[model samples]
Target: MASKLSTTPGEILREGQLEKRSDSLLQLWKKKRGVLTDDRLRLFSRSSERAKELRFHSILKVDCVEHTRKHVYFTIVTIDYKEIDFRCTEESCWNAFITLALIEYQNRRALEGFRRHRLLPIAYEEQEESEEPRSPSP
Candidate 1:
């Protein structure tokens, strides 16, 4: 198993086993333990290899499938129609963490966009503003 470094430079929020359901068998599930950072969620395999990564920007939304007394099942859907499901203990509150991370990421992106727009000059608007008004002919 090969170990890969995280692409995003952010603090890790949570790291533990998250049960992922099998596509073919609803009864079968797999345990993955990995780091959930501010920008992405990475799942590692038994051999300590990076198995999957879901970035905040790629995720459209997170949904709670079912919440029993002990466990909460949730799914994260990406923009490209990819669905990743996980079951965690109720206390973990993985759904909330994911949502908050996404919100923070979006806010950061919006701020960056605003800053970029400020740096760019509007040529047409500037030309209009610089031109002096002419007097009407009699």
Candidate 2:
């Protein structure tokens, strides 16, 4: 679990180690094995058995805070306004990967919503036309 990131259940978009700032008072950085999938981002820690899942539906956006020669710092903002900080090596570009994946997920959801709403009205219209009594075909 520490060395290999889990890729089961969902398609693996990206997998790597990232440092997450802890929510404790000290705010220490802890190394976590991260697995990005189509649905969510899973973070696993050596000390914990359960993986922390950041589902895309709950994530509002990924904000790139700063980039230095050695590291790139970013924040993941949840829909509820909670922010989680993470950083990776500058060469890794984890920020970009996460952002791209999130945007793609959002677009897919929007398209699904549009299709559902668009199809329902068309189906209703077809049903209404068929139910209407047709007079003599002149």
Candidate 3:
């Protein structure tokens, strides 16, 4: 709850969790010499709920990668083409994004496209006439 002498919120957040309040954990990670542990991760996962907010969605792209083992997948997120990514090992991309956003922001709305089709909100290429949506027969 108290600010550290040498840390800002964002800086602390980087190490804590993929959630918004992760800077503190990040700061501790930088200050401490020990290996990053799962206990800390569990703590951060419980302490913050930043990953649930909608505002962070446009900036964060969440997806899943098939692992070396079949039927096993992990969440791999890239933000704004940045090299740094979020690790969502506990669940699928949808669950990861939901969990992260909840930890980060209270109000959240995931676009239908992301869940239904993994589509980009903005249109780039026009679909062929046959591909267009058709109305049900009267």
Using all chains and alpha carbons, the TM-scores for the candidates as numbered come to: 0.74, 0.89, 0.23
lDDT by residue for model 1 over 21-119, one digit each (tens)? 778755577887867887888888787675688888898888989999999999989999888888888987777777777777777788889877875
- Give the runs in model 1 whose Cα sits over 4 Å from its true position: 1-8, 122-138
lDDT of 3 by residue, 5-102 (tens): 33332332223223221244462321111111111122223434432322343334434444433232333233565322233334223334333533
TM-score of 3: 0.23
Kindly list the per-residue Cα lDDT of model 2 for residues 1-138, writing each as its tens digit. 122233354888889899999999999999999999877999999898689999999999999999999999999999999999999999888898888878877887898999999999999999999999999877
For candidate 1, which ten residues in a row score worst on lDDT? Answer: 1-10
lDDT of each: 0.77, 0.90, 0.33
After superposition, the stretches of candidate 3 with alpha carbons farther than 4 Å from their true spots are 1-58, 68-79, 86-138
Task: List candidate 2 stretches off by more than 4 Å.
Answer: 1-9, 136-138
- Candidate 2's displacement at residue 67, Å, is 0.6
